[model samples]
Target: MEFTAALREERLVAIVRGRDPEASFRTVMTLVEEGVPLVEVALSGADALDVIARARRELGTEAWLGAGAVLTAGDAQRARDAGANLLAAPALGPGVAESVRQGVPVLAGVSTAREVAAADRAGAAALTLLPGSVGGPAYLRALRAPFPDLPFVPVGRVDTERAGEYLRSGAMAVGVGAPLIGDAADGGDLGDLRKRAARFKAVCA
Candidate 1:
């Protein structure tokens, strides 16, 4: 399936953000094992490009691995070369449009109606509504009220176990960090990640 369809269908994108590639890989692998089809590796981490390459090589068949925290068009280009199927930014930048124009699916960040409209105009496939806890899911509902047709994915302060609340509120999907896959939070074990993914699936289902 195409990256966009995979992401829109699964509705659970695992984010790998940290300084340790080994640890991050372990965490991501757990999510993959549990059938979480999307993985986001923030580019600021140590050797993130290499990690993305490895992840695509290892998990591309089953998971849509990509880069997050992309800060520039150059970074986005590098991610594309490294095999990221998607690009996720903390903020919307014109370069994000440039990257998406290159055939990379992008989730641009937006906080207000103006920004969301701008992103839509820029051709962003979707928007990532950040700082999710400032107003929680209710804020998402309100944001969607104006752009009822727009798609917004929540990227922060998500209660993975309670993803139903966010989804019902307006989120296209919920990103789960440690709670979905990191062993440090739950013994850093793949089993925990699998179970959590299952639970998320059940809730969303």
Candidate 2:
């Protein structure tokens, strides 16, 4: 399915970023097992590309694996080669164009009206509202007023309470990192991670 469609249906994107590559990969597998349909491995994490490649190898070609924090054309290219079906950036930059050119759907990040417009014009599959907590749900509602047709996925500082609020505010989906993954990616508790994932899924439901 298309990334936007997956977002609308799943209503959540599990972001995995950690200092340990093995632990990070394990965290991703745990999320996938929990039925978190969309997962993004931030490239800023250690050996993120290796994790993506390994996940792709294990999950096959059809999984909704994504590479996040993609900043340049090289990042985009490397991400695709690493088996990421999607690319997400913190802004409308070279990576966005490169991802589009490479036929990879990209979640271009935006925090203002102008950035939203610019990302939409750049052919992004969707817009990721970075630091979604800064303006809160009210900010997202305001943004939707002008760009009602564009898909917006709110990221950052999204916990269980805010997830539902963002969805009700018209977010196509929400990207959750530390709040969901917690220290699971840093060799925390998978059992606790499972419980947290269930809670998030319930909220998104």
Off by over 4 Å in 1: 61-63, 183-187
The deviation in Å at residue 148 for candidate 2 is 1.0
lDDT, candidate 2, 25-123, per-residue tens? 999999999999799999999999999999999889899999999999999999999999989999988999999999999999999999999999899
lDDT of each: 0.76, 0.94
RMSD of each: 2.2, 0.6
How many steric overlaps does candidate 1 have?
Answer: 1
Compared with the true structure, what per-residue lDDT tens digits does model 1 show for residues 82-101? 98878888788855866777
TM per candidate: 0.90, 0.99
**Which one is best on TM-score?**
2
